[model samples]
Target: MASVARSLRKVFVGGLPWTVGTNELRQYFSEFGHVVNAFVIFDRNTGLSRGYGFVTFGNPAGFNSALNQQKHILEGNVLQIQPAN
Candidate 1:
């Protein structure tokens, strides 16, 4: 079997609502494309949101789509989305 090489499509999301969860993040981003994975960074000690997260897309197209958008509003808060290093 041949191995398929896929380009990683990950984006850094910031300014998330304090109450935002992984499921909500994935649901919101899913509008752009297939969401491979979604996670919200948390404060290990407090187990609370760090106001940031990551969203991975199944393909580069989805990543670009979300990136090109002006801004995303989640729960009345504007989200900061950028290409993840």
Candidate 2:
């Protein structure tokens, strides 16, 4: 459903807390702008968070907004954000 995973409008967020779920992730990122998609990766077998996720924005403005922010904190933990590979 995506043109490409490496677009500037997409970001890879690592260091997500176990408590951060898909909906929560979407909500947090909504501050920047309309979030096209957001979800936290999870371990398939254990059903726990894999401590990483991806976010796709509706526009590059949202992506740049998020990227320009100095820090991102969620669930009391700082997150590592980078452009999607």
Candidate 3:
């Protein structure tokens, strides 16, 4: 049998300071669910956050539910949540 790939979602989170790192991002995403992982995309040269990143939830149900209710003002920025590739 083929192993099933995990169901993960991505989010567009902007308005973070350049100092924000993966751990902080993961902690912020934890409010939605059990964050399997979180990372802020960065530029190769400047090594700065690209103003967005991905967040993966360990539980699919929790992830989808979060997509419906999670939004701006709480994080101080409007975040876009969507299915990952």
Give the number of the best model, judged by TM-score: 2
What's the TM-score of each model vs. the native? 0.89, 0.92, 0.72
Find the 10 residues in a row with the least total lDDT in model 3. 1-10
State the lDDT of candidate 2 residue by residue for 26-59, as single tens digits.
Answer: 9999999889989888999999999999999998
Clashing residue pairs in candidate 3, if any? none
lDDT by residue (1-85, candidate 3, tens digit) is: 2113354455555666666788988887787778877788899999878877777777776577667874543245556666666
Q: Give the Cα lDDT of each candidate.
A: 0.89, 0.91, 0.68
Over 4 Å off, model 1: 1-7
Query: Whole-model lDDT for model 2 versus the true structure?
Result: 0.91
* Clash numbers, per candidate: 0, 0, 0
Each prediction's RMSD to truth? 2.9, 2.0, 2.9
Over 51-71, each residue of candidate 1 has an lDDT whose tens digit, in order, gives 999998988788889999997
- Which TM-score value belongs to model 3? 0.72
